[model samples]
Target: MSPRRIVSIYLPHFAIQRWRRRRFGPQTPSEPDPIVLAREGHHGPVIHGMNAAAVKLGIEHGARVTDMKTLVPHLQVEDAMLEADVRDLRMLSGWARRWCPWVRVDGKDGLLMDSAGADHLWGGEAAMLADIRQSFGKAGLTARAAVAPTIGAAWALARYSAEPQEICAEGEIAEALSLLPVAALRIDQDTITLLKRLGLKTIGALAAVPRASLARRFRHHLALDANPPKRLDLAMGAIPELLDAKLPDPPLRALRKLAEPIEDIDNYAQVLGVLLPDLAEQMDQRGLGARRLALTGFRVDGKTSTVEAATSTASRSTAHFAKLFESHLERLDCGFGFDAMMLEALVTEPLPQSQHSLSGKIEDGIDLPHLIDRLAARLSPEAVLRIVPQDSHIPERAERLIFAGSNTDAAWPAHTRLRPLRLLDRPEEAEVLYAVPEGPPAQMIWRRRTHRIVKSEGPERIAPEWWREKSQTRLRDYYRVEDSEGRRYWIYREGVPDDGRGGAPRWFVQGLDA
Candidate 1:
């Protein structure tokens, strides 16, 4: 075997750079700001939590927005978009696959590829590192590569040591990473700072101290040592694991349902609500958002149902999320009432937001959605439908009517959409008298109300769309007309005279009160 060349690729400046680009999205005025301060320091959009340019501008990871603003008076600070970041990380991971197949995404912003025999493809370790750097460089990414016997050492060297890429000979991981700071072990800030303050700064320093004392001083270090890839797989042994966990910048997840059955809809809702909200909060706490969610509802009756929906944008609001749940509730069947609902949100994306909540006037009203939910729960999801336009030429089928939650942005084409607020579920047949073929019904008796058409605008003929079975025998000449009461009516002739498709040339009141 050509040495197992485990490579760690890290993006030290991902969050900061992404924050800057989002803040400067296409339409910022020609302005001088803290970002300008970064530019002045010759920082080429490559700013990190600890880059000298960022430090000079006083931007620390845990620093407050007000303090950052004070540090760089013109600093254009931004809240992180964890959803977008995770998305980018996933894309980067797939892209990193070009480097090695045994690639495991590490934490939020790193990747570890088991290069092993693959390193020789680029001639050697040094050449491989160069190629990796060049590849990321072309993709507008700043990455640090390191090779080590163990994942931990490579993680430490890539992140902590600024020596670019560190390539260690096989089995030299402990020795190779010993000098790295305790922070290189990817511990929490308090632990790292505490270790440094206690003279336990480097990995070697921490390692040399009595294990009991070190464990006593920082219990987190012991816990970190015990962390594993899958949450269920807790680690054992003196596993000096990689300090970095490659988390996707884009979000995706798969979940399994539990054996227990959920009795109450509210109870079922409560567990999932608590779990999903808490998990999402953790993501938000980490500056992230989820754009898609999949819910797998398992019942005690050996039956399973799955519901999936994608958001037009990323979100974290519990209310907005409950709305997504409405889509799947019908299929859940409440079998033996549900045993469990395992929800997994994927296609995580960064939420687009401004600094403040746009500080606007608070609009007050009964939340119509809350009412809609109650109504939908009581009625057939399809019984009460909302009109949604499908992109097509057939008027009736041109728009689809679907359950009205999660999906509400249905727009109709203006040319064809002079639609009335109320349309009969099915057109109401009318007695019509027209002089010309396929012309407006001059006088029509609709719904027991006899009315004469004062004026008409269309013989706007719609030929039957042969592809659709329902529309195969239907042809209509739709007209928009106003009656004496100044009420507008949308009426259509179902069949034209002597047409091939056999049907009475019946008139119907399709829509009323445009």
Candidate 2:
């Protein structure tokens, strides 16, 4: 049986590196100017992290911002988002799963992978480490990697080794670690200081000391890192440490390697026809359905073109999915023609099977999801929309436009009064002649036209939402009135006359009734 192997990936400057890639594009130039990340400290702002440039200038972490400003007048400072850094680190670890399945986050800025049987896939351990570093470099990250027979040894070597990519051969863990500093044991700084004071600075020197003497010195310590013997034992493989690997859900995807490169849209459609059914069969087996799907064509020149489609509801129907992609296949630029095709279900939901009608009759009503998918494919997704009622009393906030497929079943609030068929984007100011100060308008001039009120029905008063609006905000009184030509208008008064919120009440045309 082969011995267990572990790989440690250390990201020394994760925070600032991530900030630079996001602020500037991934192709950011290496400027010599120092950059530091600052966070709010109890004593005002302090340096949380720094880039390679700032490190060269001796600006260490936890330095006061005021002091650093005095030292380097041209230093660039950015607010540190530590929480976002941790999140992106987890995502980066997940992305590393392409190399090995058993991968987990080691600390705030490191990852540990059980690369026991996976190293052969990349030829050998050294080649795999090189590939890992090159991949991270391409993704705008500086990574150092090491592989050893134990997790502790790999962790120590990845961080403390002189070389960026190091591999410890089998049965050489102790010899490799003997020359490293006592800090490499992952112990506390106080223990390291004490060990150095006792003339035991190296792991080899510490190993020469009696275990009984070391235990007597650290017996009163409670923290995990305070025990150097346990850490040394773990690193030397005398004690066992298990890695808590992150296992992601299996993705629903199907791929086909083509025999020859084909650029025709019909050929692409044929490939998609086969891919969709395979995905549908996988979805059926799991009693699931896809809400979003992506079709990607890998070209001979090493580039890829992808077209995506989304449905109003979960569906596993191959015909429906194929129809959605059919119109989009023409949009793919084949370059040197596609050498492979892949179909992936990016989003899915549980969908149980339903019985079909025994009469063999066509189902009543429109297939709304299929229709929406087709329309969204033809026109842009933003071109199709559905207006859903919002939970607000303000007329303008009463309803909002969302993509057509979402919130299809949301119920509108029941109202005793009728609303207009069409509402204007914004209310237009109008001059009104009222019979009474608070009564509905008898005549009004709007949009440079006069309308004589023949019939009128409302004084529907709606108050501003106090929690969301300022206390000084005025209330509104909406009226539904019809002119002599039978054309109706929805008009509102901004405030009651002399109510003290503002000047005399102002009238405006809110919408046009059908």
TM-score for candidate 2, residues paired by index: 0.60
lDDT of 2 by residue, 251-317 (tens): 9999999999999999999999899889999999899999999999999999999999889789998
As a TM-score, model 1 comes out at: 0.44
What is the alpha-carbon lDDT of model 1 when measured against the actual structure?
0.65
Clashes of 2: 0
- Candidate 1 per-residue lDDT over residues 1-514, each given as its tens digit: 5644568899866765555556666333333344422221232232234333555665655455554566567565444567788887877777776766677678877888888778767898899999998887665567899987666667778988758888888656657666777667756676656666777667766666675664455444346543211111111114544433343344344344555666555665666666676557656755666766777776777787776654444566667667667655555566576656677776666654434325753234324545455455456455657777787776556676676655466666777446667776778888888887665668888778888878877767777777755644867788888877788888888887777667668788888875
- Looking at model 2, report the run of 10 residues with the lowest lDDT sum: 357-366
Superposed model 1: Cα runs more than 4 Å off = 1-3, 16-32, 35-55, 212-222, 225-514
Could you tell me the lDDT of residue 467 within candidate 2? 94
Per-candidate TM-scores read 0.44, 0.60
